[model samples]
Target chain A: MADTDKSPDSSRRSERSRRAILDASLALVGEVGYNKLTIEAIAARAGVGKQTIYRWWPSKAAVLLEASMALSGDAEDEGEWTGFPDTGDIAADLKHVLRLTVDQFNDEKYEAPARALTAAGAIDRELGEKFTRQLLEPALVLYENRLRAAQAAGQIDADIDVRIAVEMIVGPLTHRWLQRTNPLTHDFADTCVDQVLRGIAPR
Target chain B: MADTDKSPDSSRRSERSRRAILDASLALVGEVGYNKLTIEAIAARAGVGKQTIYRWWPSKAAVLLEASMALSGDAEDEGEWTGFPDTGDIAADLKHVLRLTVDQFNDEKYEAPARALTAAGAIDRELGEKFTRQLLEPALVLYENRLRAAQAAGQIDADIDVRIAVEMIVGPLTHRWLQRTNPLTHDFADTCVDQVLRGIAPR
Candidate 1:
């Protein structure tokens, strides 16, 4: 949503090279994990110079973040979703997004590399904070927007804190993925969505 | 709450040793991390024999898990909640628990070991699951019981799934702690409880 004016030709060419870099990053990271991945290795596999890789992105973390965003299609797909779904029915909208999320979690290519970045972030405070700003926070905005819309629509109860409400939907999926306690599936997503819309108290 | 059985003589002796082991395990793990922390190191540090360490724990990860839990005080406090507060108000009950959680997260002793175990858990699935069952899951069960009781007391909207709802509360805090995006404070905990209650819509 931020950049909408890149010319098609330039964009397409950039996309091609970007895809190559991402593919290289993913394969290398998957094979050796992040600590051992090198710019030289990325360039060799990407068929671009170390300069090319660094010119577009500053560090391995940057490249990997973009590469991850681009490759998993989580970034691309979620990038489009931007904030939250706005399909009128708040519950249905949340479920729809979460279901798509479940599919992305199932992607094998995304899983290993994704896990590597997340684990690294936990230890590396700088990298983790940057990721939140560049990656996680943008996605959170989508939730913020949707929650606001829901409030305006009177679907959500009055006096709800938009930030906290957003977490209700986001928290469970993340918990499942980070912990790997259970499968992140459509059914589970639906259950989470349903649970949040209404309270757990007996009516 | 389970086998932390109390006694005048044996129990106190056991508790003291358990504390020593947990303290040793936590310090050693923080010093060396999960990959390198060994039974020998932990036992040596605790001034107890390696067999004494093994008599209680089967592996380094288990020792670390229990150590981290014990360090957090969550292990001892599990069933001690006596269920969520019921001052005829569900939100208040939640806020009370969350406030205590904030205090726990802020404790310096818990922070290093918790971070260490959590980081290791991310990469080691079996240990991660074990950590969940022994540490995270039991704590989560406390929330579940609270939600169920809230349902019976007619505080929440009967239809909500307590499991999912509880995750919403837990997920954000865990995500923040593990990722270190922001501080976990009593105010934030209160916000989480309040927001989930009214829902996240602009009122």
Candidate 2:
């Protein structure tokens, strides 16, 4: 086939089918979870040929990975992982983003799909790696970047290991959400910001 | 139906079957996960009739819950919530328990069963609350008591919310474990204690 044979119309058709496939994949994954989420199920739900999905994505993991990206708006960002937001007030910026996270955690639309992906990642290693590479590492880079900025501004101790420090902030909020241990709210977000900024030790 | 005339032999036999059932239930949950696990399977695996399982536990969740407590150790304490340790050095106690926690998180034997039960708890509120009571609350009380002691000692800020502070330490480690985001280690524990104690600000 000539280079001209790869035309815009064909590309558009492929893109539409791909979008349908991803939507169905994500929805089914959330409804039934990953193990029960199958190639046949996705095709049946998407109203597309199973061969069409296989032609584009290699496996259920690949399909779910892309579906999750679509769910997270990664396509618009392409594949570039820009790290955390760095407004001048590191504390406020961090709090602001965390507050948004609280909202996302509380939102039903986002929760189920995210849970589906996460549950699958728990037991499946290769899928887990794909999730880390495609979704999680990017989010973490943002944290690392924000911490580096804090270090540069002398807002944080220069000797601090930023990678581990990021977890200090994220781990608790995530723990609350994943474990359903407590209500994660704006007040909870404020508490997290307060504790992280001020030493827990008596000043 | 005279109570005093009841055969002790039947009751003893019933108690033995109960242990066998719980053991089999945990083994199946650890292997097949909660969703795919069944009463029939538990009964068959235990070499007991299905009626024997239903006569005690109401569902697979109940079975798993009892099995979880059984496998996690009989805890032999007087059925009360245990709080954190107090070496008077707040940081040291937190680190010591967390180091033990790192061992628990990495233990292959507990890992799958714990992960499966935890994942189920993630989406099911009633089950989640039960887990919090049976599995999580005891640990929290320990921290609560420890923090109270520290408050009295002025090791930590007196006005600080102990529950929130405890979550700060717990949230990150759990997020890392559940999300497959990173490793939890003794170094990770030490760093969390140091950073949290010092606060993230330049001291």
Candidate 3:
């Protein structure tokens, strides 16, 4: 317990504290929401000194951002990160991913924290940019990579902008989820994939 | 000025107060955001009593909702509400609408209040549903109507759900605007329209 910072035991204790802080962040944000979330509260919930949190993360948003990333399997542990699937069938692959998205969006544990972050980001430009860069952008890169692969395979049109193309697949689901305009369903996910891939116009 | 509510002069005065209240609501929301905005502030800014606002609208969200509707030309003045255009060329028409949306989203005056409401809606389920039904749904209906017309003209696939089809056109634009993922531009709008109409697959 008295080991120095450079020692393996010390590092293990630090890692445990980090995990506790992140888990507390997600739980607190889900309960009290991002606006009400405070560093002191997170520290209390994690059973750590407030200084410990400050030493590691700059802000509550930063803590929550990392927590959300970890929840989505986008943690810094590169070994656990799985990129978008590509089975050479772009439409089918997209549907699979989107269906999973639907399930995630519907999951109460994920929804509260995600919605809190999203809501906070909407009004706070700094947090919005940070969230976009730290969390959203990397996830988007996977879609872009998949679309590029599709282009190479002659599945997607060669001229399509993969960046914008990624939005087409993700946007409607987000819009539906955020706006609560309709039920998020597997059928809707499959429809989005079909329409985007085949186009809504008559062939 | 002592006339009753049935009097024309009293009605005109009430109309002026209503306009002032809505205008003040928009201005205050822009300056302070939805959460910080209060009935007292709006009333003070509008030069009316707090009871005046409550007498007309149930809550601040309602006041802001009306202001937003008016800003978007969706006011109860039926003659002023121009439905989505039907040029028989669905792509051209959609691009036209989306380009205007890009402009609206970019406008600072519109951006502040709209962002406030959107942020509030994200956290507050009741407000979110009210905003959707009161402000957003009507606008979505316009898109649906246009898509239905295209379907009738055989410009769109007959089997496609017009409701879902409209999302493909509007979703990306909204996602870019809200998430600030990329520039909302006429070119992006046209690309969304073209891609949705033509499908992303090789023709």
Candidate 4:
């Protein structure tokens, strides 16, 4: 394509336009919400042509997801996105990751975009699946690996399905975040860890 | 108000108008989605005057909530809205209720409106809080009571907070439903109950 003209100046300009578009998308979605937000508005706000947005992102949802990821700086570097940590203690590791999640949810930059993305996911199934696969599932696999280590150490039952078990760890935290039912905190995260470790009921 | 004329004919007409308005709201929300839905369109489709809608419900979100509740038939009869059943087995009772939830999530009538409502809730905090208070909290209380019974029966630890423990039971089910990550099923609900009962790892 003519746009693929390989030149240092062109590459720098491309990067600048991309950043502008993402920034504009995030700001507009926060102000007007995802449903009313339009490609034209994003282009105008970004000081780029409408064609620039259309060329890079297929939909507003696409722009929002990329912008969210960029703003959070979590998935920007694929190499740095190295799953959850394993400090040898399953409970400690899980708590550590959950606390980070709580922090992310609490951050103002991430909150509005994340909320918009979640609402978009609920209404638009195809976009929902794409982002979930692109973003959520990879993180879940990390939990699965951590649980596997615990099973091998005999801290957990070997027979338990780690995939399902992982949900128990993450579900409550995400539920509270999405529903706004309660204040998410490190204390809440620690509670989830402790409860899962010994079970909610008595042995 | 002038419409408060207490006559059988007027009351019958009022009931007809209410039903029509609700039906129109649900159908329109499903077709055009919550963002595009308006009182004008709802009135036009319901074949009722716009004043008929404004006289009863304050906004589209209010109308949608009432219509959704009516469609689900869960909160229709206050007296019949008994809490979760107690079959003497805590696990069995929880599983039964969750399976019914799975069924509701699967139903077409519930699915579309519910999707719209959740998206609405995410963007509209005022509406979200209102519906959560009026709808979700009541059901959660039922779970709270059930867990307390389990605690009383010595099935659960007396010290375990029923409020948090209840989230462990319902969270995964809701997380899955909201994300559309998996098909919500009786089997999935049963797995959650079984996993929670015994804990994910060995005791």
Candidate 5:
């Protein structure tokens, strides 16, 4: 309604504004941190009105979560979306997926916003739960499915809990990421895959 | 020098003040979060002068770190600090230690301040590194030593890196704690211990 332009033109403009807002949100969060980041600042940086932000998102946390999702979407587009890579070899498949995870973690686009959301998620339980369910759970489900496949193939113990087993593979890499203890490398990914499979395979 | 009273009375009063300041810092961080928490507010709530807080700790992070350390000290007093119990059963010992960790994480005294520091540390690299070194590394070293003992006993692969092996044990619990996905329970602890030991035991 605000636009004098046609429907397609208006839609394109709206998409541009949305991208700008998300980019600004990520940049500001990286520079100042999640706690100090404000919608007004995001609006200023994006050259959009505060009303434009509020119209699209409920809170700063919501905005950041969207920005994070956008980053994840871009990574998925970069060949990381190939789910679980079930090529009959569970270890190689897992290593492939985890190596891509390491790449995603190390990507400059993903780093700042992910860091911001994680910090915000720590104190704000509601936001944490929302992001976890919407963002994290879906990714974990892919792991769960892959593990289930491995179980069916007899590569893993029939008694192994796929959910917890998935945690074994994902947990260390996530710990390293959140703790910033070391570089999240392909080598580290390979090690995690090796250890986790060794744990779940029949004695 | 500032106290009118001398020796025993002054020392007792100083100790009381320190405890009060720590309590105030924890309470404020829980209520307002780490970003909003201020030393001025801590001093006011503790019924001490600003100078009193400054004399004891260098910064707000330092105060929270001390408070967090105090909670850790209390947990240690509850017999959790007894190190990895070597009953020759590495699985049982690691599970026992991890169970104690679940208890400490569940304790109310540790929750708020711990959450505050984690959130703060996510954005503030210096605080993260300081706490990681001072608080986290010591606990990790205990696990490392226990794994070394297991290696010597021929219970574990001598070639396994204790550093990454330790993460196999610690990472999942930490992930559960920070993510607040589920109750950090004895059963969870046992599962992690079983899975990790299975991974590192000689094939």
Candidate 6:
């Protein structure tokens, strides 16, 4: 085969292997949980050799991190996915995004793997930091950017720290979802946005 | 021996055994993490038989639950510890309590066991619900009661749902603590309380 033709063919084959490995990691972690997930199992499930996975990823946690990033639509080509929307109304825009978050949290496809990753991260500090940097930090940046725009538009108090503001808006939903304290619903998301916008103190 | 004398002697022995068991469970979980914690190790550490632990608790989670409750000063006879203070100033009271929580989360003695239990609960639904009900719900209720009192005093909006309000006040701190995304400090706690009260939107 010509060198040019060989390069594209090999690249396509490598891409297929990468996706299979990531998919296998997610499915295995969901079935057996993070603790039991191993390179051997992922290799078997992906129909690839253990060395193939090792060459591509450093550890099971690394593989799971990429899988989760891909699942959340924040993978390598994340620029293709537009971030938090600005409908010119911060309240409505926040609510719209949060309601979608509520749906994502409730989806079965996301739930099992998320629980596994979160559970693992809670116990493993090193893994937790990596997970946060790769999977969580990008998402937080989006919130910060949106809040910055709102501040510029005079929708938010200029004096407020947007980093802390972002946490206050999203933290309640994350807490409820993690603790399973109550049902996650669009109404709950809307209430959080409204309450944050208008302080709980008497108006 | 006199029957009355024997009664008191046996009761003292039982009380000593119970305290030992609870302490051992906490220490063992801290050393081994929750997944590796076992009834046998706790019994050995406490200098009691496995049957004694089994008699008092159904599983390792039950033992750990009681241990955590005792550590938090929320076990039986909790009235003496005093619930969330109602000092007529909601902001001051919340910041005070949250600062204390920051200290507790940072304590080395509390960190290991808490991480283990929290990690285990994240992956195990049955245990997670029990942990929430036993360890988390009471703390949340304290926040709820404080918010309700603020509402009654006309400090907070009467229309707000106290449950959701409580989450907003505490959730950011919890998120930061669990994720280790940032330092948990008195300043951070105070900021969270202030932000929730005054809100992010313009004055």
DockQ of each: 0.36, 0.58, 0.62, 0.54, 0.69, 0.56
Please, what are the lDDT tens digits per residue for candidate 4 over residues B111-177?
A: 7877787788778888878767776777789998988887777887766757777787788877788
Looking at candidate 2, what is the lDDT of residue A100? 71
- Candidate 2 TM-score versus the reference: 0.88
Model 1 docking category: acceptable
Question: Model 6, B180: alpha-carbon shift in Å?
Answer: 0.6
Q: Please, what are the lDDT tens digits per residue for candidate 2 over residues A1-203?
A: 12234689977777788889988987888788777889999999999999888877789998988777776685236432234567788788778778877877787766777777777776666777779778888877887887687777878777777887777777788778777788889888887877776642234
| Top model number, lDDT | 5
Better of 2 and 6 by DockQ: 2
TM-score of each: 0.77, 0.88, 0.91, 0.90, 0.94, 0.91
lDDT of each: 0.74, 0.76, 0.82, 0.79, 0.84, 0.82
Worst ten in a row by lDDT for model 6 chain A? A74-83
Clashing pairs in 3: none
Give the lDDT of residue B81 in candidate 6. 43
Stretches off by above 4 angstroms in model 6 are: A1-7, A74-81, A200-203, B1-6, B74-81, B199-203
At residue A138, give the lDDT of candidate 4.
Answer: 70
Q: What is the C-alpha RMSD of each candidate to the true structure, in Å?
A: 6.2, 4.0, 3.4, 3.1, 2.3, 4.0
In candidate 5, the residue pairs with backbone N, CA or C atoms under 3 Å apart (3 or more residues apart, or in different chains) clash, namely none
* C-alpha positional error of residue B34 in candidate 2 after TM-score superposition, expressed in Å: 1.2
Segments of candidate 3 deviating more than 4 angstroms: A1-4, A74-81, A200-203, B1-4, B74-81, B200-203
Task: For candidate 1, list the clashing residue pairs, or say none.
Answer: A83-A142, A84-A142, A199-B157, A201-B156, A201-B158
Clashes of 4: 1
| Candidate 5 accuracy as TM-score | 0.94
Tell me the number of clashing residue pairs for each predicted model: 5, 9, 0, 1, 0, 0
Q: What is the per-residue lDDT of model 4 for residues A44-80, given as tens digits with 9 covering 90 to 100? A: 9999999988888888878887887676464435343
Candidate 5: tens digits of C-alpha lDDT, residues B74-181: 766876676568998999899889888887788766777777787787778898888877878788899999899999999999888788988878888888788876
What is the CAPRI rating of model 6's predicted complex? medium
lDDT (10s digit) by residue, model 1, range B154-174: 666676666777887788788
Q: Compared with the true structure, what per-residue lDDT tens digits does model 6 show for residues A11-113?
A: 7887788889989998888888888899999999999899888887888988998888877764225443356889898889889888878877898777888
Candidate that scores best on DockQ? 5
